[model samples]
Structure formats: structure tokens, C-alpha cells
Target: MGAALHLAHAGQPAPGERHRTKGKGGSGGETFADFARQVYGDQRATPLARELLLAFGYATMVAHSEAERDVHDVWSTARKAMGATRTGRRWRLDEAIADDAPRYVSSKDREHRVCEAPRLRPHPDGPDDFRNVRGICGSLADWEHYALEKQLGTGWYKYHWFCKRHLDHLARVREQLREPNERAPQPVPNRGGLLPAYFESDWLGTYRHRLDSPTWEPPVYGISADDWPTPGVEPVAPRARLRLAALDGTLLVEADRGARR
Candidate 1:
């Protein structure tokens, strides 16, 4: 803040400058730590510190991590900082996007303005004897098929309700048909309280025999003395003779070292 302003006032080597001075503000290629030290004469990387310097018109050399992305973007940051939406409450993505009631008034072909039809019309017959008829949208063929199906459940016709139902069914069917064969990775269950992870290659084959084939289980290291170290135990040997399972089998492995031999 003060440092950024001081640099600006000093006409100091601000970032993106053509000057060639050492230990100056915005010299070049400063990470968050580097930038903090250069700007504030301190080594702490604070969000407030970054915001203050950037707000005073400076670009950061560092990229924001993916986790912080949802609540922060260039557009929102700039707008909120400039006091553009001070009085009005800020609308998030959810608030900005929404469903609304169907439009009752719209231009008909942009030429004629069509008003809605009256819901109630005067009946020539007595009001008590008036019909409460509802709409049925179907062609003669549809009517014939529907009537036949109604009689026997024997025809290939769709009721209006069937359109939406059948559409939903079709969407599900399409998704089922389009799904790829690739399976999602399951958790490794961390039998030893380790991260569940995977590599794409066949290095796992080295441990496969112990995991899958019949073997006497070791009590301390389970079935994997090849990898995991036992709890509260340490080995004195150097790591020189350790054999990593090769994904590429073409490379000839070195002999077990003389110490082990």
C-alpha cells in the first residue's frame, strides 16, 4: 500500500518498467514471497498485501490456485473494488441465473400485439347448465389409436402425458447408451492410512503376486515389506540396492549390491 504508493511517487522501478535498477519494486519474476519482500520489505505473503498493491495498479507475477477461483475473478474483483456495487447487494452466479414465470405478453411476429383470450365467456345456456369442457389435443388418427388402446391396451399411440414421460425415458436411454467404458477409480481404502492414488502404468505388477497369489503374510509389514515401512521401526541400510518396478521392462536391472549379497 504505502510501499506501492511510495514506489509510484518515487518513480521507482515499478513492475513493467524499462528501468535497470537492483532491489527495486517490480524488478522482475517475483513470486508471492518475492513480491511481498520487494513491496513491503517483509517476507509474509498476505492476501491483503497482494490486494493493496494490485489495487494500486500492478499486475501479479503469480497465478491464483484453483481452490480460490470460485469466489474470485477479475471481473468481480475490479467491480467491487471500484465501488460500482456499493449500495446494491452483490449477486453471485446463483442469484444472477434463475427461472421466471412464462411471458404472458409478447409481440406476435413483431407486427400484431395479441391480447390473451378471456378466461370466462357468457354462455347462451343457463350459467348453472354451463359445460366445464377441457382441451384434448389429438388428430383423427391419434383419436382412433387412443380409443382402440383404451378399449384393449393394444395400440401404439401416445397420450399427451406420454410425450414428457417418453422424452425423459429417451434422455435416460441416450445417457446410458453414450456412457464410456472407462470406470471411475475407487478408493484404495488406505489399509495403512495412506493416500489413495494410482499411476497409469504396470509397475503395480511387481506387488501383484504378493497381493493376489497365495503367500504367508508377514505380521509386521503385512504383505508389503517391499514398500511400506513398519510403524515405529527404522532401517539402517542405505537406499542404494532398492529396486523400483520398471514400467518399461526393456531396461536390464542391476545386480543386487554386494552389501546385500
Candidate 2:
């Protein structure tokens, strides 16, 4: 039997089944499965809360691939540099700012308040790097967090922060990144007379249309039958053709006169 079939025969517990195993923190800790059950079993736990707990459990239990591990390592390094913990900790903006100068001032009152912002990614799929994280004003952050919780139908808020403006900007950016087919089709302008006769003209007009033809006329200024160059009949200029190599080296294709046919 295949390894997958053998593992299947081994009889692993269902997702909702209560079982204890090593947690994400390390070995011998409270198991994710048990933790998930505890969260689900609680009467006070909301549906969103249960889902969030379950997602965390699922993420922890799944083994990371080599590429995933590499990404995780980079994210870990960035988090460490920003003084963030594995279990999310709130960071004070005042600590990073100088006593004389503040990075941000309140738009409402123009007061310098010490904002205790949670170290969070701007969006769910945003990079784990510190550059993507924003530290909004304290009152604004609290209101935003509350609004998010209400919208999600959960008491627990995920570690993703954005003020109204930032949130709207991210939404617009995401919309722009969506596939062309996924986006709503834009209305095409009706330009009945704007198009040239060659484009909208009948078969006879298209076939008979020529630069020197008496029936043909220049649609735009600075263009006429006398200005149109005759194809194959005119003496063409011998221009040097250049080819670029993979390593940034350029090769002149028409270097040798004898090589040219």
C-alpha cells in the first residue's frame, strides 16, 4: 500500500475529535486539538472565536514545507527585529519615538498621545515584515478594532490593523490586483464617426483603398499621398541590428557586410 493509504489505515482522529498532542509553542505543551476543544466547548465563545481558534490549531498541526519554512524564517527574523513576540504583544509607539519629536500627531486635537498599537500586518495576506505594519492612534485603533469584531461577529480580533483611510486604500489596491475577467467590464465609448473609413468601410472600399488612390484622403494633418513611401520600391537605409545577450552583452547582427544577404 502507498504511504498515504497506510497513514489512512492508521486511523487518525477527525478534525473535531478531542485529542492531545504537542502544541505549536514546543514539545510537551498544551496540545492544539485540546485547546481547540476547550474553545469550542466554552458557552461564552462566539462562532467566529471558535473558527479563529480552529484555524490556529489547523495551521499549527500542519507541517511546513521547505519553501514555507524559508518564508517563516524570514518573517520570524523581521518580527524579532521589531520586538514582536511569538504570542502577539502590544508595542508602544512612544518608545520608538524621540522625546523631542513624535512620528505621528493626532489629526483631531493635534495632541501627542502615546499610542499602544498592536504589532499587526496591514492585511490578512500582507507580508509579515515590519514595513507593512501600521501604528494608528490609540482611540482610532480601539474604535477600528471594535468595528472589525462587530463586522466579523466575533469578540476576538485578529492581529491585523488599519485605520479607515488605510483600510480603504488596501481595498482599492486589492481590487486593482484582481484578474481582468474578475473585474466588472468598463463601458466602451461609442465613436461612430471617429474611426477611419478603412476600419468601418465596406469590402469594396477596403480593397480599393490605397495611398495613391484618388478616392482615398488623408484623415489627419501633415499626411498626404506624396508623403507615403512606396513599399519595396524605395531604397531602404542600412540600419545596424543589435542583439542583446543574457549577460548584458550586445552583439551587432549586421557587423560583417559579406554576412548580409
Candidate 3:
């Protein structure tokens, strides 16, 4: 699928441009294509990673072309739909998913399938927030959720919330489509579904870096130094004293620290 997409976007090579060429070893060294081939051909690189590298190379070579624009559009749409924004932005995962109507269609049958909300970051660091959530097919979601949960049980609540919200939204959409005297809305084909593969692969190591590094700054509300206690000299205790009073005709009374002390 990635290769097909790449080819579709890449179109044809320009006049006199070589699509593939052998690299020569020596002072001239390796060409960019040679380096790309070496990276893609490395036995250590996963299939998904290799494909991502190839896609990236193709995109770069065809920069500013329609292919690049299409690729950018797809990624941009996925990012927006997944709420993959920098922290401090309002979490709008539910809103974005509802608006986008993301679905997973079976490659064999082309039927819509149940989708799951997968987290981009499995926590201690990642919060139960929209920024970490991405929509994926049920199988992939289950696998990812189980793997993460097995390793660390954190962040499940965020996944649960996202799934519930997404399901409810889908139900509402379905109901609306079934309403009498209303034309049923056409099913919007899934574009974001492929994004799960990218997320799962942690393609180009960028997502991995994002997960490992603490880039997100959660918003701090109502926090101020004024709310904290100030340090100063210790308060002095009140001293007891004797009091004397005179009223009418030289009447006098004296009070001491007796019982109070």
C-alpha cells in the first residue's frame, strides 16, 4: 500500500533523470540515492520503517509537487483528526473524531470495521489527554493496548474515554443518517486509518523521540507565588499582663496571668 501510494504520488521521473542507478565507491563517495538504498536495505530496519524511509525519500525528491502536497494533506488531516497538537492547546479529540468521522475499512471487503483509540504515548509521562490519542482499527488497537498495558497499566483510562466518546459519536451519526425524510449521509472513507501503522512503526524515529522526550507542557492554572506561604520571622507569643481598673468612688480591680497562663 505504501509503495502504491508512493508511486501514485511520485508520478514519473523528469526527462533525462535516472530512476535508479548504481553507486561508485571512491572519492566521489555515495550519492543521496545510494545512502537511501543502504538505509532501506539494512537488515535491521523493519518493513514499516523501510517503507517510511522510501516514502520520505520520494516525498523529498518530489518536494513542492502535487505528490508532496497529497502526502502533506494526508498527514495534516491525520494529525488534526487525532488531536496530535502541542500541549496547552485545548484537547479536542472527541470533537475532531466526530467532525472527521474516522473509520477503519477492511482491505479485503471494504466494509467499515470497529475502530479503537490508540495512544501515541503510553504513560507515566503522557497524560490521559487528547493529544496522545489516535484512532486505529480494533485489531491493532487491541494489540497495542495489550502490549502497553502489559508493560505499564497507566493511561488506559484515556484510551477508554476516547473509545467511549468515539463510539457514542458514531452512534449519533448513524442515527442521524437513519432519520426519516432525510437523505442518508454517504460514508466518508477512512484516511486516518493508515496513520495507525505510522504511529505503530514510530516511523523515522520521530514519534519515538516524541514519546521519550518531554516536549509537552501541560497548562498550569491558578498557580501563583501568592498562593504559597511566605517565610519570615517566627511570630511572637502574646504576653500575659496584670490589669487594674478604677470606677466610681475609687473602686479598683486587678487581673493577673493566673488561670490564663
Best by lDDT: 3
Q: List the residue pairs that clash in candidate 3.
A: none
Worst 10 residues of 2 by lDDT: 1-10
lDDT over C-alpha atoms for residue 216 of model 2: 43
Question: Over the stretch 1-261, how does candidate 2's per-residue lDDT look in tens digits?
Answer: 001000001112333432233553443134444444544553323354344334323332333211113323322332233453345553221111111110111122223222334434353435553334443333333243221111122112223333443555435544543453234232111111111110111212322231123354232211211112222333222221111111111111111121111
Q: Model 1 over residues 45-145: C-alpha lDDT tens digits?
A: 23443343343222212221121222124223423443423346642211111101001121112222111122254434444532313222111221112
Global local distance difference test of model 3? 0.28
> Which prediction has more favorable lDDT, 1 or 2?
2
Per TM-score, the best of the predicted structures is 3
Off by over 4 Å in 2: 1-30, 65-261
Off by more than 4 A, model 1: 1-165, 171-261
1 versus 2: better TM-score goes to: 2
State TM-scores per candidate: 0.15, 0.16, 0.19
Q: Order the candidate numbers by TM-score, best to worst.
A: 3, 2, 1
Q: lDDT per residue, candidate 3, 1-261, as tens digits?
A: 112121111223343332332242221122335435644544433454454344433332322122213333333333343443466364233223222112222232223222444433353434543333443423322222211111021111112111343555444544543442133222222222222221122221232233342342211210111111112412212221112122221111111211110
Candidate 2 lDDT score at position 126? 55
